[model samples]
Target chain A: MSAEMVHTVSPDGPFTSISLAIESAKNGDIIEVNSGTYNEHVIVDKTLNLVGINQPKIDGGGKGTVVLIKAPDVTFKGFHVSGSGESLSVEDTGIVLDSAQGSIIEDNSLDDVLFGIYLKKSSGTIIRNNNIVGKDLPIAVRGDGIRLWYSSDTKILNNTITRARDLVMWWSGDTLVKGNKIEKGRYGLHYMYSNNNVFEDNLFSENYVGGFLMYSNNIKFQNNIFARNQGPATGYGIGFKDLDDIVAKENLFVDNRIGLYMDNSPHSVDSWNTLEDNVIAFNDIGISFMPSIERNIIVSNSFVDNAEQVEVRGGGTLAGNNWFTNGRGNYWSDYVGYDENNDGIGEIPYKSESLFESLIDSYPNLRVFVFSPVAQAIELASDAFPVIKPEPKVTDNYPLMNYKIPQRYEAEEKGFSYKLFVVSLLMVLIPSISYVFIKRKI
Target chain B: MDTKNILLIMKKEAGESLKNRWFVLYTICFSALALLVLLFSTMGGDIAGYSGFGRTAASLINLVLLFIPLIAIITGGVSISNERENGTLPYLLSHPISKNEIFVGKFLGLLITIWFSILLGFGLAGVGVAIIGQQGDISGYLLTVLLSALLAACFLSIGFLVSVYSGKASKAIGISVFLWLFFIILGDLGIMGTTVAMDLGIKQVFALALLNPTEVFKVASVLVLSPRFEILGPVGVYAIRTFGQQGVFYLLFSILIFWTLIPLGYGYLVFTRLRREEK
Candidate 1:
């Protein structure tokens, strides 16, 4: 099978141009292009294997698309795709797979393109192990390392993407994005209007927004690491906005501004998401649930050495074995509590100093005094006098620190019950009232 | 004098409207806003996770209330004023038709055109909502469109009155634009100022806010569509408490009738008086 379809593209024949070689290729063929700079746009419209020997390059001549794949069961490997121009017009991707299925794009390098590889309305594709590095400073460009737009059922794995504006899956569903290293992008792994997608074992480090999930549902992120994503405008390690039914667990967020930010969402149950075992050291706030956020479960997370541990400006259920590091537990580094029990857990829960912390939060300049002796004394006095730390309301008695707990949809069920009660009451009243009047006359 | 002549004049006005650039532009702008309404409404569920009837209705009402007056004032302001400025009103008036017939025919033509635009916008919005699998409250949408159309008619009549009274085209345009802007933006600002000055509670202020036609439409539409969110403000609270659910419908109908008749009646008197003065 290898011998029958082995076609070599070199200086001879129509091999100089990629388009010419692809025109003559058959199913199960290996059209191996040799090392040269071929400035052409190649289209694969058949089920075949296309291999690039010694890293052959396809340049788009800075005008149009480089290569477009419209075939099922096709593989593009070991190529350096380059030369995508900047345009505010319609989408011009370096490599576009439009309506292609079962395609594998692996072990390729995409550089200096508007978009590295865009999968538009395509499904059942595996985009794996590609090194996509955009330009250092984007020239007013709007592109992604690998974008899946209006596509579904694709697996994106182990790809290293950097310097792109956004890594996006827009208006798509049922995707598995795992084991990728995404950095220096505007937003890492932005999911918009997509549903039922699982993102796990990914490292989103040093990005503008280290993962923004919005307008999506039934999406889960687990075992990911978010680190060093700090900028004036670029922060928020994991931000969930207007999302529902999302489950995040066993993730490590260290030294990022606002480790977990949940905003404007309701009916989302976040439980057993371990902000423990994470070095949430040196951030503005560890967890911030804003005013519009409601009905979420924030439990069993450790807040260690952050400027502010937890800022709950919203109404949500905060319960179940969580640890705060303000002298009573979990290593504040300013802890004044003696280990009377010698148990790992502190004897008393920590009482955060309120007025001082509020001042520090509103006026960040006061944070310079955070490590001062005076500040330490104040924190100790506040703890001893007990001015802060709302009383613990335990929802679950024994909360596991590391397990991925499925979010119970009990709230939704209760809401449904109320609706049913109203319906039944109306059903009973309408008929009973009419029957009584008729019976009275009779 | 006859119904056939009135119909002919209405058709002629409609045909003339099709060629008007501003009318075409207005239609496109309205269509765009309708698209935005659909996008926000559809995505609101995924973003907020509480895509109730109230939220959907609130969004639709908010869009209509914001844009309707602007469209109404612009379209209505120029309808008669532009004809007079262009020296075509006298020629049309010289025909055998009575002054009342010409006025009624033109008014009907404009109303029909604006209603057609509103329906087109709503149809597009409906398709978008369906595509996003959002089940919007149809009755709420219909109520909003109807009330908004009435509001538009009121603004149109007001604009036509200005067009009839003003000496120059520029003055008419300026006055119409200023009136719409004042009602929409400045009126809210003024309400906020008065609230602060009087130290009145937000509810009392909102009750006073209903005096502003834009705020009235906004409050009325919200009441009709989303009774649940009606308690968010003083105006809403007072409205629900005073009117109850049935009262809400009654108040809306009353407001609609009042605004519609007052402006059109004024415009009819001014227009008739102006015609006599010209003669």
Candidate 2:
């Protein structure tokens, strides 16, 4: 057994470049690159530790992948990686861990990158504290911030990504994504056929769609804030499709077009997921369910001031789902039920039905008249006559009298916009005062 | 058209309405509704869990489409028919004025009055919202005011057509209400039903949408004001990409102007060419 060698590469050193050092290096060797621009691309094909001192630059000169790790146990840290090719078809990447297992990629700043930190068929990888910003091109051409394909047991943590398409995961299991701040993209965190994952304490804002999980199971999403992700076709805080055994708890979804859209979640079987203690506020629709969606344990969430709190999109029913669990139900902004016993539960079962909404469900085109007098008139009439109203899609037997989520969000800050209130008051006040004065003078 | 006689008839119509306190009442009515719409919009957004000028403007759409047009058409609908019914049209025509001049004068007069009321309504509402709300969705707010004004003008022109076509004031009023129902209320539903029953896609639906001015108004407003048009799915993106956002807007405005000018032109032609029984 031979001892691992240490090589220091510099512009004027024994080894002038990374490729030169890599060619001479053996297995389990450490290559230190000291603070100079490397204009050439390199591929690590063996077990090695690559450390950059004072943040060395790896510029691809606007062409191929900046750094390619083809070996297992390759650890890269503290490099400014950029200048990848703009060809989406070629999958140009800044740093690609291709079939590299147990690799550590940390503290890399990727700028003007096509794809930042791409892990393909890599397992047991750690991607942490990297700042990734894609090109400011249109979303179609711009690349993903962090993409994991067929990678398992990967931990992506504390990465701040902006202006990228998505931090995407596909067919990856036992992956943990935590403490990331993502904004100004299409989808903040997109998952497809990835199960047994944990996502926590991340912030997603101003994206087209915040985060979505599809065709996977046994995922846990907790304590994340999904805010201000709005667009025409897919502006949802968090959307789930055909999933099972998921727990989405203590998340705050605010100011999106649709907060949580469940499309056939629980996956054609008796529901097993738990959606609890989340606060969904200021969305167009708090929860939009596809007609085939059914049977999830939904409880203790606060649904505040959404336009349509619950919309059954293709009109079958949400009747298969459980609106309340353990004698405790969600809190609705429109619920007028009282808690005489002071147990934080409503006295009567809360019915979520209005005639106008039913009309819209039957005829999607009637949505143009959403806030019309006709809709309002029908709602009023339905409220006045319960017999006229059909069965509600969601009925909470013990609706909570107050919001159950302990966390506060940015949406709550809009509640007391005192500056606006004062200005409006002055506007109305001056006119009335002048009118009164003129009358007095007359 | 004789400019001098047109001015004379315009002054006569304007003076008559002013004497009846019609402008004052209409302005006040519009202002009240404007404020009500503002309040309603904000409150509705709060309930839906989102608040912005776009949401507010989007919510007030129904009021602007339904009520603004109703007011405009009603005011314009009786302008000519009432004169004929009161035995004043003969006297006005006897004063060496052409029928085109009379028709154009009455239209310009009523349109100006309605325009003033519309301006006042939007002015009050916009000023109120601008001062009180966050400036995030201000463009959408202003666009709503602009579109609603165009809607009012469109209906006003339709009202003129109905007025000149009918023999009596009562008949004109009846036809105006029916026109309102057909365009504003029934037009949307009929299109939706037909699209569903016939299994029509976006192209057909869009073609049908062009058939009604009200549908044009709704689509234009939704495209501009609401960010939730993504609910239409990929077809929406395809539509925007195909039309180009500005192109659809230009087309809508052109159609609005077309809807305004076509009936008004035909009505003027008929009013001039058709012989009056009394005269």
Q: Write the per-residue lDDT of candidate 1 for residues B161-275, one digit (tens) a residue.
A: 7766765677788888899877765665555445546655645664566566666676666556544322232344455666676876686667666776777788877787774
lDDT of 1 by residue, A10-79 (tens): 6664567877877888777878888888888888887768888888898888766778999887899988
lDDT of 2 by residue, B1-279 (tens): 789888777766655554457777876777677777676556434422335455556567777777878877877788888888898888878878888888888887676566656666666655565555533354565577678778888898999888888778899889899989878757656665675587566666667767778767767887787645553334345557678788878988888889999988988887888788345
The per-model DockQ list reads: 0.01, 0.11
Interface RMSD of 2: 6.9
**Model 1 ranges with Cα > 4 A deviation:** A1-4, A265-279, A292-300, A313-339, A360-442, B1-279
Candidate-wise lDDT, in order: 0.65, 0.79
